[model samples]
Target: MTKFIVKDIVDKFGYDVLAGKDGINRAVKIYGINRPGLELAGFDFEKNNINRRVILLSNKEQLFVNTLSEKVKKERYEYILNENIPMIILTEKFTDKILLEIAEKHSCPVVRASNITTSRLYQLVLEFFDEHFAPATEEHASLINVFGKGILLRGKSGIGKSEMTLELIKKNHLFVGDDRIIIKQRNNRLYGQSHEMLKNLIEVRGLGILDLSKIYGLQVLLDETKIDLVIELIHLDDEQYKSIDRLGIEYKYIKILDTKVPIITVPVTYGRNVSELVETAVSKLKLDEAGISCLKILQERFEEYSK
Candidate 1:
């Protein structure tokens, strides 16, 4: 997303100024395929100058125009060189000599876009921006980051995943992914996504669909979150799998992109206050990392009592 002044475009492309000096120095942004910010492909009018019309040099947005006659192509090229178009974006490869001549003569910036399909290129570009612009740390699972960690609430969809997130939001925690988290791994970092179908909206079994942004006043919902933990809710019962309050075992790993992430499981039952339990689990994990294990502490205290 490098910013280019109109003069920069002209000076680089080798196009002759056929018209307005008003736009000559006006600023524009050029996205080249090889650049970090311009990794996407597509014909975008979204950010175009209100007064300037972008002239796409490629035929049908294709990188190469094989359908046109060589003579016609040359004529088009000459026409472009002589026109006062704001900027010219090149897709097809041209010899450096010709390109240099055009640049030297016209002073128009020569930018080469990737050869991918316009739609795909645009998608890639958008995705890149989205990932690059995401926040550094996310505190909640409802929002997903581009790293592909789907922190989902896996307890029957109604066990207050969204509600708990709303509470977490009140605690000033950033939201990342929600109800339907779409996880994808890019460069080994786990990113999470809110399914487009459920974006900014949460479904509470008996309560139906709720707009988190509206109810929470726009501070609650986030576009995505980087998932490092999975908080699973379980109904407490006389089941064999009930977790004990002991330092017993540690580090439950949830598999995503073949990577194992630490998992924290919390049990829920009537009148037990599940959300508070989850918050405690999160806090305990943090303490565990700092070498303060609650279970281990309890065990040591018990052994001292026995002594």
Candidate 2:
């Protein structure tokens, strides 16, 4: 399980830990952030729901808490201050001794948020957790930026994938990752990147590992990219080459996580310039995305003439 604990938040945001130091290691259950409202009124607060989330208390919650009767207020504080919550963040430096006392009594982590607006803090923390809790996987493929489109190249070993990558990089294209790509699915989209140790590194057959950043320049390297397309390279015989799709009407995809990325199957024959083919494939993808299809245009022209 992905363990995003209270200390993780403290480390990420540099928030001052005000109280409840003991509960720092409690993992944030992947539920999400919560702003206590009904719970603040000492009503309908579910332990299972609120206990797993990181609580954010801003100006509105504090003002609402001020209106509660002392009996209800004490009850509310004691009831919501359950054990093992990730942390309660007080935004805009809002602090209360009573709340801190309750939090300390139950050992719930409370952090004083930095000098950022509550909404911006919410956005920043939510984005962090959303990405941290996202589903991820690794692929035995190379990712490159071709014409601003992220294309993942996959095939058997020694099939000229690396050579094609090197060629593409030489044409001023950016190299995202080679040999292995770490992919994460966020908000129904797949993002591809290289492992930190393998960043800007590509291996070629008959040649040792090469750092493209040092060889070319750091500008040739990309930290990450949204996976826009996938290319499957295969060795094809004469009959297979003849069987290739002549029209650009056939649509294909490769599934990664829950997202389906558009895919192209290109046959790699001897002496064929795979780099140019990749560039052409991406160019065609760009045209297709813009609703400009050469085949569609030709079909319309032929139909008009026949009519």
Best by TM-score: 2
lDDT of 1 at 90: 48
CA lDDT, candidate 2, residue 129: 86
Q: Which stretches of candidate 1 lie over 4 Å from their true place?
A: 1-97, 100-151, 238-240, 243-248, 296-307
* Native-referenced Cα lDDT, model 2: 0.85
Candidate 1: tens digits of C-alpha lDDT, residues 176-258: 55666666665566667676676777665677887767776666556756566776665666352455544536777877676
The TM-scores, one per candidate, come to 0.52, 0.88
Model 1 is weakest, by summed lDDT over 10 consecutive residues, at: 34-43
Please list the Cα RMSD from the true structure of every candidate, rounded to 1 decimal place: 12.7, 2.7
Instruction: For residue 256, give model 1's deviation from the true position in Å.
Output: 1.2
